[model samples]
Target: MIREPTKKKETSVTGCIRCGTCCKKGGPAFHLEDKPLIESGTILAKHLFTIRKGEPAYDNLKGCLLPSATDIIKIKSQKSARTCIFYDEESSRCKIYHKRPVECKALKCWDTREIEAIYDRNRLTRQDLMGDINGLWDLIEDHQERCAYETVLTLVDEIKASKTDPLLEKKALYIIQYDLQIRSSVIKKGNVDSHMIDFLFGRTIFDTLKSLGMNIRRKNGKHLFTTTIPSDPQPT
Candidate 1:
């Protein structure tokens, strides 16, 4: 008796190995197509965080640092391992595999043609997700105009260089506090929930400024702004 020939297996990275490499890193950016998942409770709001436009963040797919070009909704990761919150290490599988984000569905590590094709298409914006709430849309637009972060940074430079008067620091603090107050007022008005405030604004302005090595403190109902002036002069 003779046995039939064995079929040779195809060698391609296109097929998932369940190695959990991608999931271990972080979850995918949610697309507009994934709005239903959030609405249906398949993906919880607690499982997400926003990457604000112009914010510097790591681009996992591209393996580089780049500022977000548009506000993007992304899934949160486990604080301990920095992996997707839905990823189950014990099972080596995603807990929500069946209902993963659109980006996750399009991802093909071996060949990224599919994901690349729709990378900029159907992107979920912060406004798209939460703009329906009354006053929230208007608040976001107003806050952006009121506190242009780049402009704030420029103000900081002016203060440090003494291009502006010494009292300019006080003025700058007033502006920053005013921005915060605007957000506070919006929250108090009951347009959006307090818990969801951060979602609407993304990371707070204080955090963003802190990342630039600036210190902000509120003492005795007054804001104090302090940052070291670089001793080395910038090249012209």
Candidate 2:
């Protein structure tokens, strides 16, 4: 009869402790239900960015990187970090907690069933918000067409196949140049807020290419491309 004293039962975490872990990782993607928040000015467009259709992005739920099927409008991170812009580091709380996005409300870190169920449902797109706006929407549409990931990826594949096609390289470079030029023109000529560039045109081609393992640099006023082996192959 060498029975020891009974051990204390461990308490399970059933609610968000506001540890700021989720906020630190990144902000939630906006959904249709969160449209009111943006429309009502609870969430501003300047605070957001878009992961445009066909862009390669990390899928948290699926735990892999893949091309987005549609626009995934999300809150921008603070500065150079992944921390949500609304996250107040000192207090470990969301500044807009009372008006958080649908995904933020649905997310339960302890039991992710709620989040995964609605992760990709009814995602809000830039068109839904600004389709009726004159000139701006047209600009965005043009940018999407000229700087599409589909065309870029195709050029990348062709470059890999030929390994020395200067013409293919030139086409890719032109697309990158157009992408940069449009963002610059929008800010300087169109008088659009520079902060809204990411939301309008998604990320720049430089970032997109780098994420896909291609590096570009300027030498003697000309851009040079260097390819590196991607650690993860494109998800099937």
Candidate 3:
């Protein structure tokens, strides 16, 4: 039978040797750019941060976070027995191929130009973080608004989590921030935290933020009037 030529399979990024030089060896500090897919403006890449240091991105003791992605699978480099977290031994490519940070994406065996681009991009990340903080909050608020009152309630629970889980810390921060914003506008009369959160998540943010202080001053003597409707979760 006449022989037919077989086409070569497309190689993914996994084709590289297991040299930790790509990631283990530190380059300029870099951060993941969370740019909006639509915006085309010049982005000053800011560092979100390195996951870990004194070792490769994924892990130090264990080897690369994704060593399986490398062409040369195990950490044969005894000098630095670390492999990449994104390395896939099976396929030999970065797991984060699509979303790898600019530095990782710009890496090349011999291309100095690609290498330079990574450092150039690293210089611009600090400025990137400022807008993201507010933007993420806006996004969270949007989710709460669109999801009805359910999402904000989750925030309340999240705040109550604890020291063991990091979620509670974030939840508390979110609550405080929301309370602050609500208070920034509304000239509230009494207790601000609980009630303001209640209203902000339930009604117009503008109105909630702009509400006049409610039930202010002592009527006869003792208790100061604060507008806090306590949460209704009974002790379990």
For every candidate, C-alpha RMSD to the true structure in Å = 9.3, 8.0, 19.7
How does each model score on lDDT?
Answer: 0.67, 0.80, 0.34
Candidate 1 — what's its lDDT? 0.67
lDDT of 1 by residue, 1-236 (tens): 00111122344765878887667657777778999998898987767777677665655446555566777777777876668889899999888889888777777666667776776577788788778867767878777666666666676567667743658766666667876787688678766466566556666666665565555676897766645544332210
Query: Among these predicted structures, which one has the highest TM-score?
Result: 2
Give the per-residue lDDT of model 2 (tens digit) for 110-161: 7767777888799999999999998989989998898888998887777767
Give the winner by TM-score: 1 or 3. Answer: 1
- Per-prediction TM-score: 0.75, 0.89, 0.27
**Pick by TM-score: 2 or 3, better one:** 2
For candidate 2, give the lDDT of residue 66.
70
> Which is the winner by lDDT between candidate 2 and candidate 3?
2
- Over the stretch 11-66, how does candidate 3's per-residue lDDT look in tens digits? 45444564545644332233335343113323221211211111112322233332
Worst 10-residue stretch by lDDT in candidate 1? 1-10
